[model samples]
Target: MIDAHIHLEQYDSEVSEQMLRELPSLGIEALIAVSMNLDSCIRTQKLATTYPRVVRSAYGFHPEQPLPQETELSNLLEWIEGQPREDFIAVGEIGLPYYSRAEALERGEAFDMEPYIQLLDQLLELAARLDKPVVLHAVYEDALIACDLLVKHNIQRAHFHWFKGPEEAIARMIKNGYYISFTPDILYETEIQELARRYPPELVMAETDGPWPFEGSFAGKITHPSMIRDVAAAWGALHDYNPGQAEEILTANTKRFYSL
Candidate 1:
């Protein structure tokens, strides 16, 4: 099975090295290591080089964090493209700011949507140019606008990771043939279970988003890629499929989406 979206570079070096060595034994065949910033993108690239097939990099700025300087964003785009295209699988963990927008408002900080949209547009253009899939962080009300951008760019290969949105957005995603990935939250989150039930297995995959931590049974435990096993199990339960079958379908979906 594959962990569809995770920040492997965020883990401690010693810890991540050991985890990467242990992943295959735990039934995890690959991970899409999504980046948060330029530094993260670089580290993810090196990790991908080191781990080869086990760790694939996805380069992009995360919207939940502070907006990156225009020059920095430009440099990242250049750096990613300058590298061998095979070094990365997609452009992502990128999208509009939703949770951060609220936090900025509460702090009286200016939150500009223009820069966010501009950044997303550039990333989408890069993905379209490279013919690579995208792993999105877009959710809830923000999902509608993200969908519009995907349509605008004519980028059909998009994965809305850990997605939670209104029925209309979900319908749009289904109609667009976009993919969705569920994190370990599916084990205890009723809303996520409903999403797994609503989205067909053919267009769904599993992820840990590891080192981001999680609640429920995952609380207090070191979030690891191995946890995707439990995620797949929960996903199977929602769809009335067994764990083994879920792994087969999800693995195929992940490979097809990222061309793994």
Candidate 2:
């Protein structure tokens, strides 16, 4: 099994190394380590280089970070432009945070879609030019809006990890052939389970959203790539497939969606 999305940068170097070493024993063959900041992009890319076959990377600014300054954005664009085409599997973990804390939102300390939209628009253009898929972080109507933008740009390959949105929005995403990834929450989240059931198996994949623990079995625990098997188990239960069969289908769907 593969953990389609993980935050390898969230752990310390020693911890990260230990986790990666243990992932295979837990049935995880690979991971898409996503970046949440400019520095994290570099760090994640380095990890990918170190592990090559075991760790793939997706680079982007996460929504929790403040909007980039002009020079910073330009520098990031330059770095992205010069990156070896195959080094990154996608452009991701990017989008707005609609439910951020009041103070942070007011202080503009958090990423604001209003300002970052232009940056994301540029990213979409870049993704289109590079022929890479995008991993999105927006949820609810925000996810719908991101989908609208992707469609408007004719960017066909997009993945929404840990998705939570209205039925209409989800249907639109399905209609557009966008893929939605599930997380360990499937073990206890009835809403997510229903969502898994609503979407066809082919359009769904499982992820751990690692370093961010889920409730129930993993409450208060740091998430790991290994937990993806738990998510797959829940998906299998929801979709009426045996565990092995569900893992296979979801794994195939993940590889197909990301062009891995």
Off by over 4 Å in 2: 101-113
What are the runs in model 1 whose C-alpha is more than 4 Å off?
Answer: 107-110
TM-score to native of every candidate shown: 0.97, 0.94
What's the TM for model 2?
0.94
Q: Model 2, 60-160: lDDT tens per residue?
A: 88875667888887777778778998889898878776666345668877544577667678878778888889998878888777887898789888899
* Residue clash pairs of candidate 2: none
Model 1, 137-247: lDDT tens digits are 898989999999999999999999989999999999999999999899898889888888999789998888889889999899888998988888899988888999888
* RMSD of model 2 against the true structure: 2.2
Q: Report lDDT per candidate.
A: 0.89, 0.84
